[model samples]
Target: MTKLTSLTIAEARAKLRAKEFSALELTDAYISSIEKSRTLNAYVVETPELARARARASDAKLAKGEGGALEGIPLGIKDLFATKGVHTQACSHILDKFQPTYESTVTANLFDAGAVMLGKLNMDEFAMGSSNETSYYGPVANPWRRKNSNATLVPGGSSGGSAAAVAAHICAGATATDTGGSIRQPAALTGTVGIKPTYGRCSRWGIVAFASSLDQAGPIARDVRDAAIMLKAMASVDPKDTTSVDRPVPDYEAVLGKSIKGLRVGIPKEYRPEGLSSEIDALWNRGAQWLKEQGAEIVEISLPHTKYALPAYYIVAPAEASSNLARYDGVRYGLRVPGDDLIDTYERTRAAGFGREVQRRVLIGTYVLSAGYYDAYYVKAQKVRTLIKRDFDEAWNKVDVVLTPATPSAAFAPGEITDPVEMYLNDVFTVTVNMAGLPGIAVPAGFSEQGLPLGLQLIGKPFDEETLFQTAFAIEQAAGKFTAPQWW
Candidate 1:
């Protein structure tokens, strides 16, 4: 018999339907596993009672010979999502213990489909950092370690907790937001599959805004199939969110294992930047080869503006962050520090609440949006953003999908890269997808010389996630699943 904790969402779902195990029993197994894996610091809150209750309800539904898509499947919700009375802090001290009365659109959709909530997962404070160290809760330890070294490495961020939890088998899947490479990079580090749907594919309402234009909800799971199933349940048109797309959500699972014969997968020429590691280059080239072996054609295309994506992303994302974070002033909710005056109260509250990375980005955001510099920085970045989008649009005519390395390198030790600029470069291959509002999926391609995981990303046209999933399934079949050794 397989340990329930080791089962993928799809496996667990099938087993649940076959009466192989009760939902309560499965939930209990996960709860026990989570309790024992505390050193990873993956979850910010563990809602065992609520999870059990949901599982019980799912059991009853199953007994009646009917249930939702994810009946009894337990999932970890990111702290960035508003879970209506559960902790929704974005892992920032500023929103300390901030509970919402409403649930995020994505989470609500999952719950409505009978998915059990394990609890809120941790993340970088206000989604500002590349490493998980910026989280108020502390960094999430990657379950995977270098072969013989005992050093702990960061499970990337800002969706570190989601990625770590999924990789460690703490949850069947997890809800994560990606503003830039938050979703893909973390999944790459933790040996999990993560997908960031097209910008409006998943609603942003009540997800704790962080660069509203770039923030999109998706799922991190043990494998490509589980990710596909989770994304199907998480995506829906929401009346509350104006940005939510109105198209019917396709059954992503149905497209899996589909033939990729004759598919043109674009290998962007500009993605092979100067600083990319040789190991990563080999993994990416191997990924293209894997696809080619699956009867797909690999075409080296050029998205010339790719070099400008990182700089433009930094300016644009922080500019939006500055505007979005303004509402957190010591006014209605969250931390409030009493001061001599109103402005003092705001200053004191923010200074004590936000982490250094968050503060730094806020300052950068403010500076770009400030007088005299707004046109020079923010406005120019937006123009560059348009050009980046155009670059992708034109490439779509030449290719069915694009393949790139998810991160410049594999996971590194926490705090290993002291310079923030060096850390920002980690998104070199990923930021362009967000800038173009296209869907992208990161699947583990291979491992590094040190035995850490390396991932290859598949970027698809906007709202064309089905193609991406099909292609990812092809790669997943070739490379096979990469699971972290159970050192925890």
Candidate 2:
């Protein structure tokens, strides 16, 4: 018999229905896997009791021949989402011990589809850093190690733990939110599949806000087929969130194995920045060739305002973050530090609660949104954001989807990047998709020279995730699935 932890969600679903193994047995295998892989620090909280209870219930449902789409699958939830009566902190000191009475719409949808919760996974505090080091829970270690190296590497951030958990085989899939490169970057680094759907594709209600306009929820899984299955269970239109799209959620898994013949695939010229690694460049060229062999027409295109995406994202995201995070004062909930007076108390509480990166971003946000600088920074970034979106809007006239390297390189050592600006550059290739409110999927394409994983990104039209799945499957089939050597 295969190790239960190594089976993908689709295989488990079929075996579960066939009564070959009980859901409780499968859940137990994952619980044991989590216990053994503690060095990765992927999970911040372990809800074995809850997971077992859910699995037993699923077993009963399966016995009755009545189960939802995700009927017996166990998944990890990112700390950013609110799970009723469970720890819901965004891996931040500020939200210490905070648990929501209400559940996030995305989590609720997953549960409605019969998914079981493994626990809350770690992430960057308030979804701020490019690497997972900013988490109050400590950085998540990538399961993959460089050739002949024992040095630990970062799994990429804000969805670091979600990606790490999927890569490490501790969870069937994970719910991850991407504000800037959160989902795709981590997946790229860890040899997993991650998708950030269009802005309104998933509801933001009950999930802790990072940047209102930029944040969107998606899934991270072992493979493209698993990712498609999980995304179908996670996405829904919620009346509680005004931004949630009203369109019907399609069966994303249905598009797998579809032909991409004559599909015009756009290759953005601006993405090939100077100083790009030769390994990444070669892998990218190989990806285009694979697509072309499958009858996809590769066309060179331009996203002229691509250079401005990073700076504009920094300005716009923090501006909204400052406003959204204001509700976390000592008076309401979470941490509190009493002081001389009301204002002093506010100052002390926030200072004590927020981590350094969160504070830095909040300060930047406050400074940009201040009286004199509002028009100069925030408004200007918004304008630049529009132009960035316009560039994609124009490109849509020529191609059905755009392709690019997911990251500049593979995973790096935990503290290798100390300078803040240098760390911000890690998101250079990924932020544009968020800025444009487009759906993007990162599929593992090849390995770096040091044997670390690298991925290729696919950007699709608004609410057109089906095409992304179709195209990404082509890449997956060509490149073959990648897995870590299981040193952990």
Candidate 3:
């Protein structure tokens, strides 16, 4: 019998096809792993019975020769996605008892593709914090650590739990949403491969809104190939979500080993800004050199708007988040506190239910969208976002793909950033891609001097996941396999 921890999605499928393993057995293996690693706090809730039932059904489909690529694979879903009947808290007290009647379109699509639901993973409350500490459920511990170092380092957020769970080998892959640096940041911190598919590639119908314009759902997996397989299944055109693109989904796995010979890889001069750590700068340069040696043509490019991305994103994201989160008043789903009057009830409920960081973002968002300041802040931010996107469009005209550092530094200790603005600066390299609504992927490139994992991001044209995956796959081959934390 093959142990589940060592298996990949492709390997698991092969075993199932050979009748060497049953879906029930695979589910049991994952459930057992989750039980053994309970201290990691990867999952906010466990739905083993639901998973097993789905696994049995998947086995039946396989028996009838009706299964697809992801048939019977147990997967973790980030709590930000609304899973019908599952407590889909965005790791906040505000949504403590909130359960949706309908599943998120991305979640529903994954189930339709034969993926069994493992459970919802934890995240930063309202997806606001870079570190997972802001989560009402508590911080998710990093799976990796140096020999003498403590194990309490952050797993990264707001998709921290998803990355930790995958790194811990609890699931073959997990669903993740990236608004700013959520998915890729966590993946980088935990030594996993995560891709933020082209904005609008994955449906956002039932996903808990963060920054509406920047939020995109993608897959976090052990490797690029697994991430690509999961992404193909998760993407679709949903009539319910107006933002869902009408384009046909490409077969992402078809181009796995596609040659990158003569492919133009743009190196943005602005990514290595003044504050970048020396180790990270060296890693980025090393990665570029490696790619050049692999037959890729590296060219220097300028995305002059890079400096404005962080500030523009902060203004735009919070402004949109403020608008999207307005539905959480006392009446609807979420928490409601009884009070003296209607106004008091709304104020009391929000104040009591929301976390400090969530409240902070709400205030920032509210202020930016306030009556007198809308044009000065929100409107100007939108204009800057347009310039960021235009920068990519012009660069893509010269190069097939752009390569840059996913983050300025490696994962930091939880609570290391006392100042909120300083913490927000962590997403500088990643926010621009979201602002531009383009696809970006973070793959493990190397490790820092402190032994923390470093990630290289590949940004591609809109709806051009094929090129993105092809480029990442080549990098993966060059980087070799990433080692997970010894806790596994």
Per-residue lDDT of 125 in model 3: 92
Candidate 1 vs 3: which has more TM-score: 1
Q: Please give each candidate's TM-score.
A: 0.99, 0.99, 0.98
Could you arrange the candidates by lDDT from highest to lowest? 2, 1, 3
Point out where model 2 deviates above 4 Å.
Answer: none
CA shift at 147, candidate 2, in angstroms?
Answer: 1.0
Residue 451 in candidate 2, Cα distance off native in Å: 0.1
Q: TM-score for candidate 3, please give it.
A: 0.98
Candidate 2 at residue 296, lDDT? 97
The lDDT of each candidate is 0.92, 0.94, 0.89
Model 3: lDDT of residue 295: 86
Per-residue lDDT of 400 in model 1: 94
lDDT of 3 at 37: 86
Which numbered prediction scores highest in lDDT against the true structure? 2
Each candidate's number of clashing pairs is 0, 0, 0
lDDT of 3 by residue, 30-145 (tens): 99999998888999999999999999999999888888778999999999999999999899898868988989999998998999999999899988888898999988888887
